[model samples]
Target: MALTGPNGPVMTREEVDRTLTRLGAERDAVEASLLALQDHPGRRLLEGAELSGRTRERWSEAEPGLGLLWSMFDTYSEALAAARAVRSRRARPGQSELYEMTELLRGRGVTVSAGQLPQGGLHITGSTRMSEQVSLTELVERMNTWYGRIIEVASAADAVWTALPARIDLLSAELGRVRALARSVGVHPGEHPAGDALEEMAKELAALRGEVVADPLAFWVPRPGAGTGAPGGSGSAPGTVDTGRYDRAARTVDGLRVQLEDLLRLRDDADERLEGIGETLARADATLAEARRARGEVLAKIASTEVPAVPGPASAMRERLAQADQLRRHGQWHRLGPLLDTLEGAAQRELQRARESLTSVTAPLAIRAELRGRLDAYKAMAARLGVSEDPELIERYDQARRMLWSAPCDLRAAEYAVMRYQQTLRPTAGPGRNSV
Candidate 1:
């Protein structure tokens, strides 16, 4: 409540009261902080864990520093209590009481026992086994330093465990579903590349999860430097988990899922295509039989002509179709896909060839029919022109008619006689009545 020169103040009722109140508040806050640090989950885990690597080595040093921190706090508490007792004996403190309170609050009045501070990387200065005295202010500062380091190690290990292991478990569950689907679609290990890859990925994920559970600290990534004070005043900076391993595993599983889906689609398409191919091949066989019958008719009814022989069913294509069916039954869709494509095309081509052959086989009969129709048309023209009894015209028409009507007839001779009949009748009909 009153301002004084540095180290010039003396006894005053108000100043001493305010100082005690301030010291009491500081003590309560310090005690609460110490309890919180002691009870922290990360701290408890670190204490019980069988840590290794950098974490294990650093924690070994911080462990003794932690003991020293508590020991120093105890001494500070005792010194504060003793100073309060001295002041409480009177309503207003004497000069000696005031001087003691100032010394306790601002001077070196607390002692820490020897062998409490480890020598690896603490900021304390004293002989290895010598006791040292410090002011309450300095003691609090030293405790904060130790608390920060210990929390730094503990928080990093905790953070890594929190981030990675559970995600790995979820991915592993999804991986199981993918494996089942793959097997259903005939994508078994050693039979398909995708299946083999899936198996390898599953093993890697299992090992990664085990390593993380055994030593989470190995995956920890600390901040820039030691003792840089933790973010948000939690006495330790937050750290990152090594997610590269987990991410790679997730990506592999995703790829396998895509491959399995594609295989399933191919299976459906192959089944549909194989059914269609069977129908096409059957149609081709029927058409070839029809073509063979037409060839016999053409040979009997028309002479001086040759018909091309009809093709038989495509043996190679049917053989491939059989192989594809075998693959489908054995759940070997990968081999069946390409073979089905080839069979479908061959079947279609075979059907087309049969139709073309039928057309060729009946060509001679078609010619004979055309010649008969022409000969009859010319006779009607001759009658219309009053030359139906013309001697030469009548003889030519009769000859062409006999050639077209008789079996094993020569189509070439019939066509020639029909043309000659038209020429002779054209003159008898005169210019206006010429044959069309």
Candidate 2:
């Protein structure tokens, strides 16, 4: 039954008991939520971290809000305890006890100090210099607001710490292995371009990891479309850490690793190819020496033709080959590989030149031998025609033979004389023997 008293329909005992029971449950829930917030890992991390930038400024304001939260919770707890104590004194609360319970539940029984409701940009409306009184329900609403703000800050920071540092560590470990492999293959700073790049990446990664550890919030990536203002500003959403820099570093290191592998393969190819080129160069020198000796012999035995001098060995190419060997010994494969290619091409060209020279130097000797063979063939043809005893033919044959067989013979003059003898014999030998 509802009683109509001066204060508008006072609640009956049954309604009073129900209201108290509900309030008690609400109080228990609020207290549990507060305790959980206190023990939250994010909250602990925020408390211990060396924060900076907007996070530092905002935490300074939020810190006071945290104190107010506990203070308000304590007041709410005491008020609930008093109400419960009063109700438990009797199986049914007396009129005075009921009046006290109503006031505790709905009236302004919770008091907060000035600036403690919400300060430092929190926007809680109260006199800054005077204390304020609020109902238990209003106080709980205020506590919820404070709790939400503080939790946002803590959780955002903790999320960045959890995600970025470990990923950086794993990437750094992979880079270390790449550096070791690079060293094994003679890819080092100042010696190879890719090795130098890898060294730079290592330094960047080291600095990035250190910065992340010291101030994770600095690396936090706010949610897209979130507010551009400070952390506690309106419409701001929480976000995770940014791993873009680390990802780029990882890709760069991987690219360098591939380049180093190619260089290592080139090193092996160059070693084999350089050895072959050295053999080719040695053969070319020998051929050139042989050509020079043959030139000397042709000048003495075959006259009236100037043989071109055989070219000397290519000393410049030999010098380059020696430089390549030095580079290979010092593990400068990046330089050695290209140098070897150039030397191999030069060596092959030199060998070809030497062979052509040898052929050129022996040309005159070949001509003199051809003349002697022509003279002998005409003599044989004359004997077959039964003109071997002809005095004119014998005189011509002996003249050509003396010129062909003698040293320093003028091959041009001897060739002319042999052609005259052949002309003289061709008509006598008849048209059927034109070739002989």
Candidate 3:
């Protein structure tokens, strides 16, 4: 009946079933009593106090009223046979395997019920019924649903993959036009020529592709709307003309388009030139997909191997901290950015794994502000720590950033450094002011 996760053992089959059954009955009673409670006189006025006891418990705890009711339904649907058997009092002997099977689900923050012999259904937690008391497993599941989550990231990647050629074509044409204008005035364009611009575009396109290929399921936000610009507006973002080189490819293709239009005006050689750009785009798409797969493999390394090997987020920090020192000694600040981003994501995720796997109805709280506060605190702490042992201090910073995985991150060193920063505060700021 016990479900094992990184945090510990979570809800037993027995516990989930009982909780669901109790919640369902309680909800029904509360709904029926609401009308009577609203119309009754005094103690007759209190004859059916609908919002008391468990109902009030759900409300005060900020649990969703409707979602809890539906949770019962999902539980019953996903584990119908087990639910029916539990309700029917037909217990199945040697049912330990049932608990084992649900281990994957419960570890993932899913609340499952049944398996008292052949009964099975999983009750996935909906957002509303979930509160802070909810397990971290559920939070991870919610992460799965989040806008910046892996699947959404993949959708964005596909979009960029699809849109890149158009962007590149436009930029390529602009480059061509600029070069022609430069030459017409007896001036040469930049030594690299319009062709070099295409190469730059290709490089950026390749990098974006590599990141996507490495992990289609992590996080990726498209360029405002992919290649910048509003939904229907012309591309206008600065450096977007470069689209980080995306524009180069776009304009080169645009160059061909302009050529085609002018040639049609004069019956010149347009068809062959336009077909060349089409070929480049077709090849780019195929190459992009290959790169995207490579990215997936990298993410899998973090998710399956690196993350699981660390025991938990806390331990993972220890491992990352150890590596960060070596990396910093080599002056590898560039590596640190991705490492921090990845560690932040993976550790926070693993933390949820621990929380969900340990306790049901005990989810961690939101920490958006905590994370920002930690970043600020760490900045000041790093400043203080950086004063003497700059190198050692940086090691500590890398370690601290890796170590503190809370949403609203925690800053142990910053708290320790409070006395150091005490005298550095602006004269006009105060305890009651926003200057802190």
Candidate 4:
């Protein structure tokens, strides 16, 4: 039965008993939640951290809010205990006990002083009352609101701190390795672009790490659909840690490491590369020398032939190769890399030019030899046919032989004489053409 009373309808004994059981469970849940918040790692970090920026400002308010949660919890606990005590006085509460139980469970039975609340009353309630009276239900709602706000701040700051600083430290360590490799290859700051960039990146990561440690919230981006009132959200966590700058720095370090590694490889291969270039230049010089000698022979043996002038050896490229080797000895691998490439290309071209010159300068001698072979073959064919003593054939053969054997040979005149001799032999040597 329900009785109309000042507080509200008085619950029946059964109703009161059921209500007590439910409120007791709520009380335990509230207690557990409060204790968990108290022992939260994020809360502890917030307490000890030298926070700055928005984090410091939010924590300033959240710190007081945390205290308020405990105080209001105390008030809620007391009201629940009082209601339980009134019911426990009798297994079946009388009318008066029922009235009090109704008020504690459903009516505004908990009173909170203004001093216990935040500056402008509870921000959730939107009230500035000097003091407030609320029911147990209202008290729990208020605490949930406070917990959401305070945890949001703590968890967001913690997330940023957890994600970035440690990664930056790892990257910094990798940066050190890259720097050492650069030094080994003689790629120092102010001498190589990668080295200077590495130095700048080191400074940036240091500053970034410091900023993350001091004010992690600055790097936090709230997740979409997340609310300020809850620690958990619809899709994901309340927010995410921003890693844009950190990722960029990581990519830069990787690129620098690649460049430095290439330089190291170049340093290891410098000797082999220098040796190969030296051989190429030497071959070019030998070819040019042979061409010069052949020019003298061609001028002596072949009359009125123009031999192309052979170029000098690749002196400039040889000098550059020497410079590159000296740089390698001094551990200046960066400078040697490009110089070796240029020198190698020039050396190949020099060798090709010298080979072409040798071919050109000896062309006349080759033609004279070819003519002499043809003339001797035809004369041999004539003798085999028993025409060696033929008056006309002997005269033509002697003319061709004199031109072929004489130094400063007239190649044009000798070629004509050989052709005339071959024509003279063709009619008589029809059966012996295959032998010739």
Candidate 5:
């Protein structure tokens, strides 16, 4: 018999030496990898940390694979050692020794007890066996499989731990500072929207940190070709941590911080704003007073003309301005901000309304003054035309003058009389006169 097995044919002396060299190197490399996995920071953290969710479930299954790796490494070492011993028996082995070496290296000559096989490790699934015989090549493949599985879980957990927890801690500190600033400004929860949001964000960050610590794998996002990309093995690629929730919370906090800064600016400028409002109210009151006086004059001088009523000062706006000042004094900047905006708008409207009233109340007096000026100008033109002594011209001019000069002047009657006087100043058409 040639003593052929799974890998086929007994090896020559040179072939056995070459095989021993390759297997020896492979054994050393696998041992180094196994020790590295044992001491990996991620694995150590996972072992001690209180885990939950996907990380918990995965660790529960993958943890046993650690023991299975060591057991399988021992089996591999023993097989390699047996092959070396067979070759060492002679400077060059004969057929019997060569056949034995081939069986140890390539045949199904390694025995693994059922107890050494963790359920999640080798995944052997035939009828129960007290021990199972597998080739040294198959045993190496099994160790590589379990090694890849355990590393994916450990590395992912470690990546999340490295990325999120410290950042969340820094955000929490910033939140604390903002809360203190809000209290100083009287911006408490239920009193201001920004304050309420800050409170909510504090809770959100705390919960986010808790979840990250307990189940970091939940926040990991594997790259598209993760499993096939890991070096020296088939496992996950080093994917990024999911920072979506943390980023949103950070933005919200930044917004609230801006709002508080605005309130601080408002506090510093409250005096200037209040003073400007007072000046505007003063102008509106002065205009209204002038309108009232004009109304009186129009009633006394103009006849049968309706005058517009002038309203009083902007007392409501002034009162609100006072209230706004009070709020500023008490550091209630949120309330003061809106009140100042309303008062500014109202003050402008009040000033405009007052000016309009003055214009309306004095309109009739202005008309009477215009008519008087027109009547006098026509009388002067008649004198220049040498018609000042004409009986009809004199009568019309005096009548229009009386109506215009008198108190409570009838503006309509004065206008008619002025027109009649102007007609009298024109020459009658006659021979050799040419309508002079």
Candidate 6:
């Protein structure tokens, strides 16, 4: 495949075969390059080593592989082209040329697709001042054009490929270390793939690795795991440990791997469904960010909100209940009735406020707004319907009821006032003189 000028004599089949044999040798050389790359251990490069000491040398060696592959590819392609040209020329030379190229490629386990080559651009650019004949000159031009991209891709791939074997060994060693530590700690050391298994694991580990690789900040989030401070201040309930849950979680990780493979195959194209490897990672990052922000906001709100809890002296409610029981046993109907009235009022208002809070937290902007509006309307109705002091009186009534029902009892006057006030308002006042 290495282009040299036709020097000594005209081309013959024997000479061409010799040249092709050399091409086959180069193919072999390139194929052998894989093991070399593996031997070099490019872990540092993968770890972000760009052109460091050993990398540059490995990179330089890796660079030559590109040209080698390119040459093999070109030669195979040319053999194909020659066949095509001979075929076009009444199946004379082209057919025979095609036969020769096909034999060589097939022998080397290579499948050359000259017909697959793009049209128009073809030529050899490598300076071999040793040639004057243009036997494959036009074909080389096309080869060079195609070779550019091939070389570039191979160069990059080789850099990683070259170091892969060593990296795998490195990972294997590390995993062994980890296993030893786990054994020392009396924990199970799980099996993991060799580092070189990335390509094999690529499909299966796509989603998981994508998250770890692309967005470390997001994936390593502090999850609300055992002992982790989470919402509702929920932490791990301290107790003697059960390993069952840990085992289940480990199994879940396996499920995650399955999910990753499914994603790689089924969602390779989609971005929105978050089915692809890259998108899954991006979505996780975004989801974690939002979740964290929400948690903080809720904590802040609870810390600062002015919502009151129940009504009065918390112990007072117990005392009042006891007093009511005594009054009832002694046939003190008057006191019992008044106490009951106070408890009802305080309980009603407290219930209403609590309900409001629940609604506001859940349906903040709308449900709470509607409830407030209803209360406002009721107040307006109270005043507009000739009960000028009814709104304030109703508020006091509610507070009294709340105090009596909660662990408190201090609204004696408010309860008595409600009773008297209740008698004054007719049933018709509410839609038709309804009682207060």
Question: Which candidate gets the maximum TM-score versus the true structure?
Answer: 4
Q: Write the per-residue lDDT of candidate 2 for residues 1-436, one digit (tens) a residue.
A: 5444433456656766787788777777766766766776667877887766767766775666667777877887887787778778898777777777677666786777766566444454445567777877777777766876776666666777678778888888888988887887788888678778988998998998777755666777767765322212332236766778888888998887787777678777777877888999999999999999999999899877889989999988888888888888887877776787788788889999999999999999888888889899889989988777877788888889989889989888899889989887866666666455
lDDT of 3 at 125: 38
Model 4 Cα shift for residue 164 (angstroms) = 2.0
Off by over 4 Å in 1: 1-20, 114-129, 223-232, 265-270, 279-315, 334-436
TM per candidate: 0.66, 0.61, 0.21, 0.80, 0.80, 0.18
Compose the digit string of candidate 6's lDDT tens values, residues 157-176: 33334333344444444444
Runs in model 4 with CA error above 4 Å? Answer: 1-18, 94-96, 114-127, 228-237, 301-304, 363-436
Ranking by TM-score: 4, 5, 1, 2, 3, 6
Question: Which lDDT tens digits does candidate 5 get at residues 1-436?
Answer: 5666556888888989998999998999888878878887789999999999998988876777788789889989988998898888999688889888888888888998665454444343422768878888878777776787688888888888988999999999999999988887789999888888988999999999999999998998888765522214433336799999999999998888888988888888888988998898899999999999999988998889888888888777877888998898888999998898889888889889998999899888888888888888877766666667888888888899999899888888888988887776665222454242
Of 3 and 6, which scores higher on TM-score? 3
lDDT of each: 0.77, 0.77, 0.38, 0.83, 0.83, 0.39
Pairs of colliding residues, candidate 2:
none
Kindly report which residue stretches of model 3 are placed more than 4 angstroms away from their true locations once superposed.
Answer: 1-80, 89-150, 153-219, 222-248, 256-436
Error of 4 at 97 (Å): 3.6
Ten residues in sequence with the least summed lDDT for candidate 1: 228-237
155-234 per-residue lDDT for model 4 (tens digits)? 78778877888899999999999999998889888988988998999999999998898787889898887665531222
- Cα lDDT of candidate 2 equals 0.77
Better of 2 and 3 by TM-score: 2
